[model samples]
Target: MPLPPDIRHGGNKACYSPMLDYVKLPTPEAFESSEDYYSTTFHEMIHSTGHASRVGRKGILEPSYFGSHEYSKEELVAEMGAAFLCGYAGIEQRTIGNSAAYIAGWLKALKNDKTLLIHAAAQAQHASDYILNRKRGEGEQIDEPIA
Candidate 1:
């Protein structure tokens, strides 16, 4: 996807472009291990779940600049979502600590607003469920805001 991001160094960062509806990931060789590659890929996939065609998340549809509050929140969701997916696949042990630390760093930067974690966890669960193709019952309510 996205030409394996810069054919040379193979992009250091993976991203999901909402406008283009594509996930840009680096080559597996660029990562320390296959697990790292898959974890990063899972993160981008979670970002894709926010596309309007999928979950219609405002943060994705509305377009926020990098480092914005919306962007940060969406990143948090993606990180947690990736963690959930990794756990489901029984590969989280290698990445969950990093994910938690990443989230904690963001939380600290955001002044440790406790509710942010709660909201992000809920949104991440929903996004992870979506990616796994798990549908809720017609009356079941699991639609949490993306930001």
Candidate 2:
């Protein structure tokens, strides 16, 4: 499938603003390669999924300091979600190592908490499902409880 229209634009950095419900991304040339640019954009797009209108993950809804536990966990969710999307889209190898290394840094800072990793991965899956327009289960009609 094609990228969401709003995510295909240009800038010098990529970010998701929950208040705006849109992703801002740098130009493809700004990154080492187009694949890297798409990878970063996918990360921000995952962040966008946490908006109140979507998956409604608390980290995006509530304010948290940059490096705080909540913020770090949210970062994990975005990275893992992006990695999952990349894999599903058949571009995983192009960015998996980089994504893994980035995720590892957050894991280290979180004190190597395996439980946190599990929770983040599950949230990531949900976010991926949301982006792909998948429902939690047939007729479930409710958000998955946040981890």
Candidate 3:
């Protein structure tokens, strides 16, 4: 006898993709926790930032051309952007389990570019600034600890 349908799959909708929507990113509500929801949404949003209609990352978003330079660069942007936001918001970093896969993908796109990390770090800074600015209201300064 076959196991229950739920048992066949994890039923955990936290992997950042919709059932019939491979092209579209997962929505925030589809996630179980706010952290997962927000992080996933933020990742996709950062990717969308590169959209040609917007930030001009359309070349990378295409599924057929996976792991190309454009795709790798954008992943760097999204990955670092996620890290920055998680840090800035005082949230725990999400587990990126497929380390080997990510490294391979990035390395392939970069052709093992020595400065890839440096460029990614810079883009992460911009992404962080943008997100912070979006949430900040005029004249609402963040409080710093007294030195």
Candidate 4:
């Protein structure tokens, strides 16, 4: 059988390309450093949350358009989702020493739009809950992601 994400320490992830042309997150896997893996996955998860079956974010799930409002909102959602997910996952915050630039960029995006953070946070929470609940078989909807 294929390795499970828990065993590989990877979270359900899509192989995402930051460029707007295409983005795809690989399925989650188990890794030794699951917190990082999960954090990254949470970013993607938050985007996928826009799917019709998920949070219904509409148009935001498409590839990120640089300097675009919708893209920035989705990025904020992913960032906030990852942070919140880490909390929900029980992983204490740690510095990989690579987040400063990312944090700054996200902050700028948030500054551009006052509601970006809040909306993304709320969406992240919903996405995180859906993932966790579906993982434990608490809900049946997540198993079928939107097309």
Q: Output the number of the lDDT-best candidate.
A: 2
Clashing pairs in 1: none
Candidate 2 per-residue C-alpha lDDT over 1-147 given as tens digits, one digit per residue, 9 for 90 to 100: 113425546767678877767788777777997778878988998888777666679889898889998899999999999999999888999998999999998887798566998899988998888788777678765355464
Order the candidates by TM-score, highest first: 2, 1, 4, 3
Off by over 4 Å in 2: 1-10, 112-114, 142-147
Off by over 4 Å in 3: 1-29, 51-64, 93-111, 134-147
> RMSD to the native, candidate 2?
2.7
Worst 10 residues of 2 by lDDT: 1-10
> Tens digits of per-residue lDDT for model 1 on 55-95?
65766878787777778888888899999999988899888
For every model shown, what is its TM-score relative to the native structure? Answer: 0.84, 0.87, 0.55, 0.60
TM-score of 3: 0.55
Clashes of each: 0, 0, 2, 20
Q: Predicted candidate 1: what Cα RMSD to the true structure?
A: 4.2
Candidate 1 whole-model C-alpha lDDT, 0 to 1 = 0.76
Flag clash pairs in model 2.
none
List the candidate numbers ranked by lDDT, top first.
Answer: 2, 1, 4, 3
The per-model lDDT (C-alpha) reads: 0.76, 0.81, 0.49, 0.54
Candidate 3 has an lDDT of 0.49
